[model samples]
Target chain A: MAENREFFNRRLHSLLGVFPIGLFLMQHLVVNHFATYSPEAFNNAAHFMENLPLRVFLEFVLIYIPLLFHAVYGVYIAFTAKNNLRRYGFFRNWMFMLQRATGIITLIFIVWHVWETRLAHAIYGTEVNFDMMATILESTFMFWFYVVGVVAAVFHFANGLWSFFVTWGITVTPRSQKVLTYATLGIFIIFTYMGIASLIAFAY
Target chain B: MAEDHKTIRMIVQRQDEPEAQPYEEEFEIPYRKNMNVISALMEIRRNPVNAKGEQTTPVYWDMGCLEEVCGACSMVINGKAMQSCTALIDQLEQPVRLEPMKTFPVMRDLAVDRSRMFDSLKKVKAWVPIDGTYDLGEGPRMPESKRQWAYELSKCMTCGVCLEACPNVNSNSDFIGPAALSQVRLFNSHPTGSYHKAERMDALLDDGGLQNCGNSQNCVQACPKGIPLTTSIAALNREATLHSFKSFFGSDYHH
Candidate 1:
């Protein structure tokens, strides 16, 4: 049973977790930042990908397929998980619940983001040029939406970084895990600020 | 921190069995001179009375050493997981709450089956294999700095507090959790234990071992021993990467 479980877990890690999530994070950060320098730059980048057969194929096969599987599996596990939160104490329970809540929020945001940016372009003839994004972002509502999105992304990444190390058997020492968790959070905050600043600058 | 002796109420969440439902029982223990939550629990156990002025079964719990070293007496007091041994009643709120750490299977009211953690330790071979029983004395010595931190890592009491605090450790995942991972570090750092380092590392590198942790840093805050859990996980990450690289290259690596 243990061996089978381990096998199943490894399969999930490779297909659903590391490659899809990590690649998406890196690409999302890079693309979002690029939009700040020049609206045309982002528009060109978006168009270039949309026009590429190989890129489109890879995105469909590698990104979307695994992403959907992982999200569904995550929700399933979360809902089925036993209520250990109330067993220990408040902070513990809250942290346990927070991870699940954030994961759900991220899933919701991802769907909406994809719909607004990608599906809308394909189905509704909605323009998603860098300028359009900037214009929408200039509104206080959308600005805050982007801000909240960035914060959630940062928290998710930082927390996931901490979890990833433990999951991979990289840093097992308590002291080391603590230090790295703090360091990861610090790095997350820095990137989040950068990403937010770029958004404000691009919009205004 | 004044000796302001004031009456405080305590609410304990209790369950009879693993499958049984949980219920809350309140007790009003007299404010003592210098009492912690453990002492308050002790007082209630001594009297075996509830707020309703009725006789009840003695509230059950587990404790080894009265000091914080044992980690056996760990409980959620006032919504925080820590050693009940060290919790001061005077420093707590008026109506404090207590509950068992939820990560492990509850044996009774406050006692839990922490065998899951111990089993993980066994699975990872969290120990050094030494030669024959007699006289193989003084195997090896580590650097002072390394020894100091290793000692800190060795302080883990198999307490499930960290596990209870973690979001990743649950029934859905077989996550061995922070306590076991820290133990892996403890044994892996040993010069003799390093021989089995590959096995331990491989175990952690596998599913429900390392990949399940969602680093919220709550474990550190929840840990009564204040073990640097995240730091150890980071170092293990670097080591695992190096190990993976070595494995990929099929290089001759020394323990």
Candidate 2:
């Protein structure tokens, strides 16, 4: 029984990654896209979000707790993992690069996003209203920053999702994996479009 | 049949201990009907004789289920890392070579340490949390679609062949490799296992977890069981994104 603890833990960890991460990407892109419409639309969406009492409560119990546990544990596994990619060369090298690139981008973007939306409001009374976002986008520096951040976020999200599918065994057949990759490509393109639209709306 | 004239010689890299110096040894095994590399090694183990007519120590390696289910018996065969038990001798050229997988620390002739793979599995918490082992009556049922993929991921044997075949797994890096990544997919697919899905996604987002897989996809090509190792990695990437969002809003998003 004790012997299976590690096995069970690994299984749970993989499970924990699927929902919040997957859901986050979709919501982030959509919410940001509200810039394409109007501040009223954005606030309406936010209001709808605010009214979800049980869901909000569940967020603390489910999402936050799991994220902290997984991130900390991820550091541990990564530091201690055995690397063996030197044999064939090219493919492994690229995989490592993408992984690193996406992680860094996602990390930086996440911090900035939190600061811009959550923390800024909490500490400095800086409202993350639609007008503020529009103003921020008007700045050349912020526009490019969001662009890079979104690109990094998109690539990281898609690639990581593809990898996660394989890790979870959803891609057992070569055909199935191929199908999933196509879906990944489709989702990535759509999300990219959404992100760009939001950015342009803010700028204009 | 004129085909009976073909013969093969093998050059094997061998070591007797972790601290011992490595050396090359040669063996010539007669081609037989339905022969595979593991069978050839078994012959060498039985006879303990080399191509030079010198008596030698029996070659040592690791193996479990011969059907590629256990993931043991994985080694570099003819420069490609795979399961020796399934490597058909007939498919190989003459004088085939064998060695322990380079991505891992070699323990002996063809055996390497795979603790890192298991450790990654641990970091991911790849299991359902049953309060206790004592008759936890029926668990939650999973959707048929998820069960299908979960069944597939369960086939992993943690042979470390994927690690050996990957170019990123090396001395300087801490990549957890593909086998463990695939295992993460296996557990995350479960209905009960979904409870910890976010944690697993976070693990991949972290260093040396999924970030280290360069998508060379050699592990998929190298796996004897034909598990879609790369595909699982991709799916996890998407899942991680969703996980990130749910984390941000502090909400219960996934149904």
Candidate 3:
């Protein structure tokens, strides 16, 4: 029974990635796409998300809790796992290494982004608005940082989705996994487009 | 006279005690025709002298079946995990470095505690069940095609080198590594062993079982017997998935 905990924890990690976290990531891309449509729509969606009843409770339950668990456990996995890329230069091995690397970079970027926006509002009484986002996006350094961050986050989710299927026994056969790989690649392309488009909207 | 002066240089990682820090000791032994790493180590055991000619404690390593059958002599030779008994001196580069498999805890010099692997084997029940000592007339026969692949799986010697090469089988993670996982395929495929197939599947349904593998593909290359460890893992994943579905909807659903 004690031995079973490791299996469950890993499954849970995979589950959380696709469900609340992956779903949230997709919805975030969609909301940012609203910026491509119009800033008013983007701000309105953001306002609705921020002002939802039990907003703090929802954030705690949905966003913060899952993100905390995934990020912390991911960091633990990254530190524990070894990489032998020199000997095994296979594509999957490199993907495995990239997954961990992107996970770490995404974690740092997420923390900084959250602090700059949400935490700043909470701790310093700063208002979050289109001007603020536009100003940050306009900065050359911050612009490049977000670009890298968005790429890392999207790639991690897309690749993670592929791994999650195998880890949870969802797609066991190589053929099925190959199909899912295409699907994940599509997700990567679509999400990346949405993310970059939103960032471009902020610049303009 | 110059031919008689040939020597092989070796650098071995040694530890005096289990709790002691590991240190490197270099040795140069008179080159002999067709000498393997084990032969070189035996010479060092005989001489107990470093390359600098200083007296030292005899180097310790585990070995059985010098032909690499028992897998008792596996260690890292020049950054590759393999059976030392089969590692020929002629094929190796100079200053052949020998170190104990790091995946397992060091017991002493070139000896490690492989109990974790055996324990995982037990957990996965890598065996055929026997009800009694009495012989039953004519056990069920396996198809030749199936038997062929099963024979491939049976070649595993529990060498612990696969675990040594694996990145997930580190100190921090409880991953059972690849060898035992492959054994799961081995035992589950046996005619009589298939009777307890569900139980074996259940054993691997836990943390260290299948989930810990990050798909690094090192174990497949590191396996000295050339067993298809990853292929076994993939097959088991399919089996385990079916098992989970059966368990969820209750056994009456399907076989």
In terms of DockQ, the best-performing candidate is 3
Candidate 2 chain B lDDT trough over 10 residues, lowest sum: B237-246
Per-residue CA lDDT of model 3 for A41-150, tens digit only, reads 88898887778899899888788999998999888778878887775566677878989999999999999999999899999988787668898998888998999999
Q: Write the per-residue lDDT of candidate 1 for residues A1-204, one digit (tens) a residue.
A: 254354345437534565777557756666767677777777777777667779778888777988887788778656745554554445434645665677688788788778887888789988877766777777898787777776776666666665665655565666666687679769687778767866876787
Better of 2 and 3 by DockQ: 3
Off by over 4 Å in 1: A1-53, A61-103, A113-204, B1-8, B131-137, B248-255
Model 1 docking category: acceptable
TM-score, predicted candidate 3 vs. hidden true structure: 0.85
Q: After superposition, how far is residue B192 of candidate 2 from its true place, in Å?
A: 1.1
Candidate 1 per-residue lDDT over residues B1-255, each given as its tens digit: 353455569888889888889899988877778888778888888998898888888778899999888888888777777788888876777798988877678777887888888888888788888777797788787999999979998888887888877767777678888888778878888887887898887787676776555555567777888888867765676676676656657666634
**What are the interface RMSDs of all the models?**
5.4, 8.3, 2.6
- The C-alpha stretches of model 2 lying farther than 4 A from their native spots are A1-204, B1-7, B133-135, B249-255
Instruction: Please report the candidate that would top lDDT against the real structure.
Output: 3
> lDDT of model 1 at residue A190?
72
